[model samples]
Target: MGKLGGEMKALAKHCGGSHKTVNDCIHIVQRFDHHLLALNVHIQRVAQIKVRHIESYIHERLAQGIGKRTLQNEMASLRAVLQQAGRKQVAEHEWLTNKSLGLAGASRSGTRQAITPEHYHHVLETARMKDPGLAAALELARLMGLRSQEAVQSVQWIWGMGTGVGGMWRRCMGKFDSWLRASSGWSRLPPFTVSERLGGGGKYQAALPSPLQSKPESDRTNVEINERTCPE
Candidate 1:
């Protein structure tokens, strides 16, 4: 590994997160290779990266048709590694601070688009027929309001916080999309079934955990008619 690659490894080691997260940060930093070279900022002197370099990079990326969210992730990764390497000042440059600039969909004067109930049911039913695992994952996300990462991963709903209060306690290793930042759309409430699946075959009584923040304002009006809706 060169200086930049070695610094990324150093960052991964110090960050001490899931392998995927660390690797993603490293990858994001690596994506700047061509631009960094053009700026004559080599891997060994990556810590010397400055705001101008970042601005130039942003312009280059934007010129090349990079999307807002992708750029956000790349900037985040760059900041993380630089900060981890004791170059916190460099990572917090004004140019890199604002999240809204050039970000598509960053302006939301209009209401967010919500998923329809009919569509939710159809999708769930179709997924169930096609793949039980996917259906179960969708159900977990819809009913419990678990993030995609939390749903697909192995989770242990251990009863510990309170005697009867049930909450998601543990999340094991798994990769799932979280950029959605909202529940998959359930515009109208879906049928509620108190099934054995919740209690783990009657081993533990399942108590509904706190509602997920992912629920959009439109979906919160009706409690009985639970609608699964994703706000995109």
Candidate 2:
């Protein structure tokens, strides 16, 4: 391995970086070598790396039909190597931003279309017919807006339910120890209303569900569950 490669491996080890990321960085560094030579610039001095070199590289890659995401990765590689070589200021230059690279909010492939109410119901009915278990998971997402992961993973029936001052309340956990509540109405419904448990250690209160389908809170009191994560 060259000095650049060795330094990169060391940086990855030091920072617990991913092997794939380190490999990508190394590839970018190699490309930069050829690019520097073509531009009649020295590759030896890390301190001599300028914004113009980076900008030129970006344009050259883009001209070759390289994608915004790929360019972004290459830029990240440049920053990593420069930062490791004590050229932190160069890496942090204002000209090196994602926006400057014309990659800010770049349209990505395979974007999902927004789900309509009719489509949602159709999916739910189909899912129910095929797999009740999957249908339950989907229903949790649809009614409560819990993330698919949160609905499937974080839910625990083992914790059991508790009777509160107002009604029966069961505390549920969401992503990152975010507690959700399952109350009386939740149990009565097909899928229990997923409530987010708020506050600190051992103290959690069931948050009131959001108004559903543009209906008033009072109107949907029977099924007062907040919509959280969007179901795919």
Candidate 3:
């Protein structure tokens, strides 16, 4: 760890939360520290952080086109660290309020759009040529409707379990069993638990059809063939 990392780790010991929460807090704070360095403000310790630092960092992020919800999260992390550093009055500063920062209203609506089949396959094929591991991860994300991070973590988890590509495909098929049944006109389907290791806090039951059910048969078949041919 570098000097800043060591300082953050020590500061994290004072933040009361679960291991994951503390790590996440430190991650955001570290990102802010990067912004500080980029702006030529080189404060070495958490205790040295100031309200001016926070203001400058937020302005920099806004100029870089960061969204309001994300800035809100960064501010929350900074506030926690500042409070721990005996700067609790910073939280009451009028200029640091949500309204002053332009983060007070309801969150903007999501702009996510569905990826067309042609576009998805085109990208997947390119990834395969460059890196098979990336291709496998992309395939898993498509079939399981996972976010990119969750897909990569799932792949790592599979490797940790001593199961390679073949095992991953088998697991995918098992999860889709309920969807296949639902598509074949079944009235009911079984529930499956999403593992806590996949980024969420704990296991939860998902009793719906796999997102793959909405996809065409050709897309599903192509993925199956690719997985089978993928090297172990």
**Comparing 2 and 3 on TM-score, the stronger one:** 3
Least accurate 10 contiguous residues by lDDT in model 1: 170-179
Query: Model 2, which residues run further than 4 Å from truth?
Result: 1-16, 108-232
- The predicted structure with the larger lDDT, 2 or 3, is 3
Give the clash count for model 3. Answer: 0
| Residue 216, model 2: Cα distance from true site in angstroms | 40
Worst 10 residues of 3 by lDDT: 180-189
Kindly report which residue stretches of model 3 are placed more than 4 angstroms away from their true locations once superposed.
Answer: 1-5, 9-27, 34-45, 84-86, 104-107, 117-132, 153-156, 161-232
Clashes in model 2: which pairs? Answer: 144-227, 144-228, 145-228, 145-229, 146-229, 172-180, 179-197, 180-195, 180-197, 181-195
Better of 1 and 3 by lDDT: 3
Tens-digit lDDT string for candidate 2 (145-164): 55575456423432333333
Per-residue accuracy of model 1 over 1-232 as CA lDDT, tens digit each: 4676566656755664555567676666666666687766674666666777777788788899986667876777777777778888878755576453455454435555658888988998999799977876777677656557656752333222322112212110011112222223222222332324443543432233323346575654443221133221
Deviation in Å, model 3, residue 32 alpha carbon: 3.1
If ranked by TM-score, best first, what sequence of candidates would result? 3, 1, 2
Rank the candidate models, highest lDDT first: 3, 2, 1
lDDT of all predictions, in order shown? 0.56, 0.58, 0.61
